[model samples]
Target: MHIQMNDIYKAFGANQVLTGVHFDLKEGEVHALMGENGAGKSTMMNILTGLHKRDSGKIVIDGEERYFDNPKEAEKHGIAFIHQELNVWPDMTVLDNLFIGKELRSPFGLLKTKEMKALAKKQFDKLAVTIPLEKEAGLCSVGEQQMIEIAKALMTNAKVIIMDEPTAALTEREIEKLFNVINALRKEGVSIVYISHRMEEIFAICDRITVMRDGKTVDTQMVSETSFDEVVRKMVGRELTDRYPERNPNIGDTILEVKNATRQGVFEDVNFSVKSGEIVGVAGLMGAGRTEIMRALFGLDQLDSGEILINGQKASIKNPFEAVKRGIGFITEDRKNEGLVLDFSIRENMALPNLTSFSKNGFIAYKTETDFVDMLIKRLRIKTESGETSAKNLSGGNQQKVVIAKWVGIGPRVLILDEPTRGVDVGAKREIYQLMNELTDRGVAIIMVSSELPEVLGMSDRILVVHEGKISGELLKNEATQEKIMTYATGGQ
Candidate 1:
């Protein structure tokens, strides 16, 4: 489908999200929508998919002006949106999720189970996905769930597909599979609106790129005509110095140590220690027990047998509260669900973990709380109208900053960051790296878990590669390379 949105304008009460934005998608072309979070990329796509009504705009589809009443209507018109957040029903079976509202039924009103399964299997095969149709959707790994979402969109026979951060959770192999499917779809005349912060993927897959900044279209150029530096400059409205900040390590004694940790069928025999003023990076594939170990360390999951030491002393942490009390803070990879409460204001989310510090005499100190929130907002460069604005309203990058700010408020001695810069733009990513450097400079130990290889190499003083729930190998900053890390991550000696 050929789609064009011209002069789009949208607002929520006082905040203007999209202002005179222009975007277009040609048939069979993968068009990249690049921008910083809160720069109106998602907002413009939401308008295109009918999730949000534009106050004023002209949506011309195939030379005819059109507007969809809702997302279902948009889908019916051959436009499918696979959001960054997978909308899978946890308890439902994969088959059920695949055919949720548009299930096939017989003339007698009975379910067409065989037909649905056959159709789902066909789609799965096309995408190189191996998830069992009978399994519960919730049991799937994040990468598997991402593939399911992609397959679901493909099942619709969509002429246009808007994929928001489609490969954020995917591993290298899975991403290759997804790229293959995308290439096949393009050959079959399916246009794609690919929205992502990953520049590598954009240049690798997209044919053209549209850059947005602060709710307006800055420029649109062919992928071959534009450079990464040029696109980034347009998106952030500034020339970013470097992708990562310089790190000068000041090593100190061990601050947190996990000795022989085991979580049964999940992860086993994990041994690692992070020293004060050091950033220890954990590298692994999506399901290599990286997140599981972090979850256990944060007391969100039980380690059947393990020892957690803080400052050379054994620590007992039975829950998140206990973990926090022990001066450990975690920024989870799944920010929407695990990191921040979506409905709460930015201030409320930031202050959630540090209530004791902001309270006095069994009463909340309003002035102190406000002051803290404001300071972090400015410090983190969080783009929001006010701290009182609901967290759900901020862009994904800003939401991540809120999560980081929340943990920073607790003043942790050992900070655990899982996918700290996932979905964050290049500019914001550098800012987060700077923040990490600042934290370590203050004698705070950090354990950073990331899927991005450059990030693992760039920010870490030491790298620990995980394979099959164990620390396969360790590499120092001067010795670690992408090839070595991958070799260790994949169970290489």
Candidate 2:
């Protein structure tokens, strides 16, 4: 299943995202497409999977030139893509999800329910995935959801499979399982195109690597023959020294303190304190109550019992308004759900948290709002046409910037970021990391909840691991590692 994209050219209005990008994927091999965020990686994937039409290109699959009108056409030609966002329906069971569009039928055209369940089970068993077949897709962990997406791809009997940032939310152990599954697929002669920002995973799983920068193909090399630094330099087009900046040892008074926080079954006994000018990372496995704890702190969830102290004063935060007034900001994990209003313009979204500042005597001030939004867009390097552009129209990385811009617009002393870079690409991820350092430099107390071990280790001044609704352990930056974090996360004493 060799895939060849010859001289691909694509553009959005005056913006040319992919300029003569060319690459080849060999049969039974894992090929990685590495690039900075907004470097045409997603655009290339969309072109290959038929989500977007290329302006000009030659797509040869198994030596046959074909044009795909849509994703179904690509699927019919043995091509499947598992996007970074899970496409499974939340209300559908695993059995129903897997067989939704292509259900087996009897002679009378009646749906074959038992056959679908058996087939879904067989698919999971074949991959050694242990998720319950009858459970709703939304109830599973992020890693489990990813595995189900993989299983869905396998069910298509695809000869060529494209995985976009598949391990972004997976744990170390879960990542290993995915690697095994990929290897099995390779043994069965399926070619895989893997897109990822993690250099370690790319080197571990990919056989060949193609680097893209500024919408152009920079170089292609065998994974064994290239170094991580060289690959990163190529992707970023510059030397990125010190991925994590050193913290200024200027610890001030505790800005926020939570004592014996409990929210019934969601989380309990979550005790933590974040000081000014420090970054505290909450590290844990998926569904380990990390997000729930943050939600309680942000006054988004009802707490059964707890005490919240802001600036050494006990404060009761009934909702986001009160929380914001107390100098607290929460950037939710689900950006689409809680962070940004997609239909609103960038100016409207950015000015949402600062309506009071942009209002004068009960009247909205559009000029002030637009001025602040423009400043934020420029400061964050958010690539949008204007502040008037709709939030939904921006790319994934740009949309994340919009969310951050909204929070920064209001001037928060205490910031809470949940999975800040969950599915962001390489370039945007670096920008976000640098932004975090800038925030801490300004004496802002930052609390981050992340499932990625590397991010926890790289960015945090301190790490707290949670297990089954309890704070299991805390470690200084010097003591935090993948092994140490996993030990505490799995209930080790």
* lDDT, candidate 2, 113-188, per-residue tens: 8888888888888777888878998887667888898889999999999998888767777788789989999999
Q: Compared with the true structure, what per-residue lDDT tens digits does model 1 show for residues 368-408?
A: 99999999999999999899999998888899999999999
lDDT by candidate, in order shown: 0.93, 0.86
Query: TM-score for every candidate vs. truth?
Result: 0.99, 0.95
Evaluated at residue 184, the lDDT of candidate 2 is 90
Clashing pairs in 2: 37-427
TM-score of model number 1: 0.99
Global local distance difference test of model 2: 0.86
lDDT of 2 at 69: 85
How many residue pairs clash in all the candidates, one count each?
0, 1
Off by over 4 Å in 2: none
